[model samples]
Target: MSQYGKLMLDRYPEKMILPESSVIMASDGTVLRRIPLPETGYRIKAGLGEMPQLLIDTFIAVEDRRFYSHKGLDYQGIARALVNNTVRMGVSEGGSSITQQLARGLYLNRGQNLLRKLNEASIALTLEKQLSKDEILQLYLNQIYMGQGQYGVKSAAERYFGITDMKHLEIGQIATLAAIPKGPSIYNPVDNLELSAGRRDLVLRIMQQHKLITTEQMRAAMKGPYIPPVKDKTEIVGASYMDAAIKEAMRQTGLSRKELCAGGYTLVTGMNIEAQRAMERAFSQEEAFPPDGKNQRAEAAMVIMDQRNGEVAALLGGRNPSTGGLNRAVTPSRQPGSALKPIIDYGPALESGKYTPDSLLPDIKTTYGSYSPANLNGVYRGQVSMRVALQQSINAPAVWLLKQVGVSYARGFAVRLGMELAAEDNHLAIALGGLHSGVSPLMMAQAYTVFANGGILNKAYLVRSIRNSQNQVVYSHVAAPQQAISVRTAADMTAMLRQAVSEGTGRRARMDVTVAGKTGTTQLDLPGVPGKANRDLWFVGYTPRWTAAVWMGFDHSDPDNYMTAGSGFAAAMFSKVLSML
Candidate 1:
């Protein structure tokens, strides 16, 4: 029994999760996104419908030559495998017939022993009787484990070529797939090109030996560049960001890992690839903001939203997605400092019908109960309009506006705008971005969508559609934009934002297009530094075409590393990326 178990274990093929059902393409079939499968084990039934004759023939020729004659185990092949593996010392050693391979794959463990081998034969024989020949072949195709956490031919195809249909396989492609079952690592095309080519030629030679292909076809298959499509190259840019997104996706989709992997769910996401690449380009420029030696690091996070779609176009959770994996974008709930003023004070003021783009407010030094808010200059500007107050990010004027708008009413308005304002009833200090738990840039982007889309808010999505291994539609995503504000009111606020960008505190953000945005800075409220500028800076803005938010701060508080609010380093990074975009 022990010896049999050992043999079964030695021959058992590794099992892995079935391929996930996901189709990442635009509504027009232009692929834009792809979700990978989870790591698990599953029976192969994904690609039985469209598998080509050549694929089946190749599997038979390489896996089990006497498949028709054998009951369940090919004794001759087993004898040959035992002799070759024991005597011939090359890495391409051992041969298990298709039935024996299937036996080990399905019923036995991966240990080498006679008892397990005998058990595998028994199960193989049983499987042959219980399942049809075609069904057995299908099961074998799906059950066999390919290296790299892949199982089944369908998954292997998609994992490697980013496609599903088996009929698509060329002769060279068939040879490559054929080569994997024999010592997957030795013939791993990604790792060793020469070994992979040699194995492929060997498979082609085997095909010719079995008369499965013409001599000319065999010759052509061996000549060169058996290059299959690139597969399994997951571009993990901010491993932290991807992890965060996956967690959120899983939570929102409500799909189990198996369902996510095999159900072919198309997750429509709000991520914008162009904006993401732009952010990557900005941060990856080492010469712009090099670290202070090794200890002092430079990192950044930015979020771009489409005002019309309310979809998150791009999000950079960290300065370097590869090494620095912390997702600063979606995870961090950093205080917006003066950035919160617009949501609490300005947005509410606009909604109340008591304020206009030209509404006047005071930026003078003033105390509201226990709290006193000051401007970045720490001085007083006697009288300023609401537009000037917002542009300068004056603390006192925002507080006064918050008070005039009624704290409770303002808080309610902020919620309507999507700011998740922590204040139960808006405190005057809420205008200064004072809250217990702050908001993420993602949420902030969602809030700003009100001003961009003439008041309609669309849910964000990253995936477009999902299809099963058989190319059957499993899930589809359709965007539904909701009305959050009136077009007139949103346009009125946009006019003020335009001034904030063109002639006010956000003048540094001046660009070619009609750019409108806000700047925010927070004082480091630490001992002996009540008014010291924090390392944090922000410039969240939008144009008719795009809306984006950029934030910059030190990993640690270094006063010298700090920028002057919207005019700081973060603003520069935002500008650099926006220019490229």
Candidate 2:
């Protein structure tokens, strides 16, 4: 080949490089999530051998009649197109072939001037001489811009028909895709099915007239239904989890948010896609958060962490958990009521070598410096054991137990187990969850894992790893665990919490499997109201395999009783998620 030939051939793409979106997958290689990069949908290119011959026939039959016969431009076809344009009295026919379309769309300018057209024709002829016909056709198929941010034939097929491989395209489906380039918006089946069907029938006619397809084949294709792609049914929801992954990634690596999302990175998360969808369905779907005129002001959040490894399997931040912002799982801790009793007061009290499950404690009405605590039902079983007090979630008995155990030791131990306790809260009300600063659902989840995993407090992690565009590993997961308490304490507390689930206020959380958990409902006082209100309900629990924290409350404080308004909703939601796993 001459030097000029080599230079001209160099202008053609050596290999296509598509700007792809980042994908997050589970450990098993299921696509748990896909985050669109700044401006493009995923575009994985297809080759000529993978494309169907029927689609190629329709493309050639509609776009260029003399494609194989012409070198670059068909002069006779150009004259025919010119006469047709003149008869129509509008600039319609360009008389461009497959090679010309590839040349103009990929490299040359889009202009109607004589000079621009001549340049485009020159490039087309150069490309034709340097490459095979099949190669040029492959380039054309992979470079056309189908609407809705799709780039290649494979992407277009998936976007329009939900099919991944182009070889699966039947005659009618091929005609539907073939007609899209005529006028992308007008002929796109997703936009206008009837109009797209008309354009598809035209392509079928062209194929029949050129004898590329038989009359019977054309008739059958015309009679077939033009089914568009299925509605997007991605089972996994990454909005909340992806946000957490990116923020944690930034914190670990000190990379900016813009740098993390600027493409060329894969985020491997420990979250299971199926578990995520199940949690979302139980929390966000219409059945769970029904708009049927009940508790409209109510919202909820949950977090499930693997007790063995601390991998975050699923997380739901709010009632509407899909569109993520202001995650309730991580920040803005609210009072955890009796749910805080086991982790903060009881666990530490038992861990301090002073308390026992069978130890006797007063459950009668108790008063401490003008602060008198009462049970939920207002009638307490006098002189109950520490185990009974925790299992039944009786208020007065907890305050008495806290007084006996002392506040500083319980508070310090709770902090070690990841409770963000209040500083000025030196009062005995801390026993009944009267802290100035409350604990987050995330902290509660991590702290509870100690009980589930025999006293090991493992840090909760969402992202499994992050990789650059070159598939180089940037960060990987490492288990960071600390033993917060003795196994005896964990075992005793687990027994009490298991009793709470089996026969106490947390009975709603009782599932087919053995569950150990506690229920909490904080009482609130609102202005312009006569009586007390309730908010911030929770049921933080764990099985031998999973530890989950579930919270339900109002976005804004209200006078409605959510437990009755949405009775057992929080525990039921947790149970629903557990049943799926």
Candidate 3:
């Protein structure tokens, strides 16, 4: 490697190349998401060609009038600055060329020490020989930090003027941003407008004198109607989805975190903006969940999937989709509550061919070692059909049925449905939604699709494809469908779930269109909490068009005031999202 290459890596390690955001777009080409770059700096990558002539000229005129004429250092400018500083007894101006400035920003510390200054100069000279003037300028434009957590010309333009293309910027706006690098704290147009305007006029004056802008253009720009941007807070879109997609992409592509961020990849996802917006509106409602306060807060998550293709239509990880926090839809394995019964116990029971929907099952309570269970309403009929037993979600009957069919069979079935069941998961309590680890909303939703899609099981996926800067496809999705169960079994299970929704605990999820689903509410014993309350609530359901699962609960451990009602929380939210479709 050359000296400049070594210097670039030694100072600004390849890892410090600065992260560029990957865009997430919907299937129909609608741009759905961009994760908010951290407060460290927000830089949307762009080439030198993206810079406008006016903005580029303004920068050169104000910062270095002899920029194009200089090789890497301007001896005359340095002499003048030295003379001026000696007379003033202070450093008022910098003599570094644009290439020198880029070197400092990229590979040197922000200090005025002589040793650092000499190093900066050495590196700048080396860089000029190694790269073109335009390349150095592009790096400078991207690495320079503007005020308010923005880096790069493209991001700054978008933040300050709502303009993605720099060429679209007005003359006054161009001058305003050009003046910011002098002292962003003082000349930031967003916070201190009056000071910024004065600096902008000074830059315009220089442009006029340098003949970079016409005298008439300078006068109009100085008169100034610079409309600053209105977005004070960065509005991130589909952050949760993007967050998961990046992780998945990294695993599949075997790219490091820095490489993935710096690759400038474009991710196309199965997100439907309409469905996502509807889910967002549902959570944003005035009464979606209990109010949050202090260290304690109620949280909920939902995942809507296209059953036929296993494409994730919409996913809300938590209340704040922009946070990119723990994605409950894909992580945070919580007990599926009664939602597990249909797939784990009942669905497999019918698929085994030994049991039919009309077959009689014992609903009477019986002891299973030290564990005994009761129905939700505390009333159990002596004998009931399998359909009625499932509809009522009778706990005793489910437990007995698991024993009759053998616990291994039900647990194995859940594993085949894409759930990673363990030895601890193979117990009679598994029939009553008891498990080793909880299920994610994504897994639960996909499992239920076996019935909705007529036994075809498609792997739930968010990203459909990824492309690089050359518009060449780097990654594409291949459809993999498995026949998880018999068509006869899927049809029978679908009928039973529909009956449950129409007449049982899932009645709260009634929709105008035909729907099949199960509501699950699990009450676990708390150490010191009172009232024998349930902690987790879940609603896993599917329509012919979409399969969805909803989970509502407190993020913290169950306290004395744990809320555990699935019908009102999960079921209602499910209805809100599904009804819109």
Query: Against the true structure, whose TM-score is highest?
Result: 3
- If scored against the real structure, what TM-score would every candidate get? 0.83, 0.71, 0.89
Q: Cα RMSDs of all predictions?
A: 4.9, 6.5, 3.4
Q: Mind giving the per-residue lDDT tens digits that candidate 1 earns over 472-567? A: 655555678777767877887788888887877677677777887777766666555436556556777887877777766665655445433333
- The order by descending TM-score is 3, 1, 2
Instruction: Give the lDDT of residue 163 in candidate 2.
Output: 91
Candidate 3 residues lying further than 4 Å off, grouped into runs, are: 1-18, 24-39, 229-239, 256-263, 284-298, 319-324, 367-380, 468-472, 526-532, 556-559, 564-568
Better of 1 and 3 by TM-score: 3
Runs in model 2 lying further than 4 Å from the true structure? 1-19, 24-42, 45-143, 165-179, 189-268, 271-296, 325-327, 362-383, 396-412, 422-429, 465-475, 527-532, 559-569, 576-581
The better candidate by lDDT, 2 or 3, is 3
Better of 2 and 3 by TM-score: 3
For 385-482, candidate 2 gives per-residue lDDT tens digits of 98888877888878887887788888888876766576787778888777787777788888899898889888888888888767898899887788
> What residue pairs are clashing in model 2?
none
